[model samples]
Target: MAAKDTKNIKLAKQIYDALSTEFPDSSCSLETDCPQNLAIRGILSAQCTDKRVNITARQLFDRFPDMESIASQEPEVIAEIIKPCGLTASKTKSVMAFAKKMTDEWGGVIPNDVDALMEVPGIGKKIANLIVGEVYGTPAVVVDTHCKRVMKRTGITDSEDPAKVEKDIMKAFPEAQWISIGHLSVDLGRKYCTARAPKCGECPLSSFCKRRI
Candidate 1:
């Protein structure tokens, strides 16, 4: 292996081990009962906090319990329910359209492949990867804003673009550890490596982080 590759491998191991100890049971923050629900929540989570998404999703699911139910409602109705998540109009359209396809064509089954998932309205690369990683147990690198921020700050990747960040992290870590590190990076971002005013001293990865904050 190249010297830099060997160094990155060692650093990746150290990061994985450190974050494993810090957040042993890290997982996606969104709460859902099934892959379909997870898919909807993932869409709702765009430009929104997971806590808000979870809260809004409860109201959304309460009104429209399933993909069929969601498909039946008008986009306006779903928009009203998810308004708290912001960008209600677009989110509603995406959810309604995606739900319609799920109900009418796919019979409410969410596909595990990235390309297939992207075919659904509002299901972008990050969300697609989440569904594939969490639902299908695939080796996926979920590069959400939090994952992007933390990884960059931690010196795991220097890129600001999420796609490039995902690719870089995939190379740094083993395939088996990709999902775990993705989840851990989010945890690190939320708790310590926050976008502004990060608590660098309290961060477990402080010693290794480039402290881009």
Candidate 2:
């Protein structure tokens, strides 16, 4: 490995240790009642908050009860229930597609594979990683807005692209940490390294964060 790359690895260890200590309880904010339900919540979580997703998902599940129930419903009915999540027309299609996949294709099982999960409309790379990592304990990096911002600020990656940020994270952290690192970055982003006004003095990574900006 190049000398520069080796130095970055050491930095990764320090940041990982500091974050692990500062946010030991870091976890996915999205509610996970069941694999299938969590998948549905993920579909609703685009551009939406976790609290909202949880509430909306509960309402959806209460009315439909099962994947087959959701699959059988008219698209308009599903849209009405999930309208609060925003992107109603598209989200409705994704939700119904996932439900139908669950009932007819996967035999009521949500797959651990990222590609399979992404086959459903509106389930992109980030959500796919979330579903596989959170549901199946698979090692995957989810590069959401918080994670993307935190990573760039901390010098984990110079690029702003989610795919590139994910690559940098995978290189910096080991497979064992693949899941928790994303959650930890999110915690840091929310509590300290916020976009507008970061709390650097209180941030655990302030000591070595390259941009402290």
- C-alpha local distance difference test of each model: 0.85, 0.91
What tens-digit string does per-residue lDDT give for candidate 2 at 129-175? Answer: 99999989999999988899988888889999999999988988889
- Per-model TM values vs. the true structure: 0.95, 0.97
lDDT of 1: 0.85
TM-score of predicted structure 2: 0.97
lDDT string, candidate 1, 101-208, tens digits:
888888767776799878877888998888888888899998988888887777778899988898889889999987788888889888887888898888887777
Task: Report per-prediction Cα RMSD to one decimal.
Answer: 1.6, 1.1
Q: Quote the RMSD, in angstroms, for model 1.
A: 1.6
Indicate the residue-level lDDT of 150 in model 2.
86
Cand. 2 Cα-lDDT: 0.91
The Cα RMSD in angstroms, rounded to one decimal, for candidate 2 relative to the true structure is 1.1
* Top TM-score hit: 2
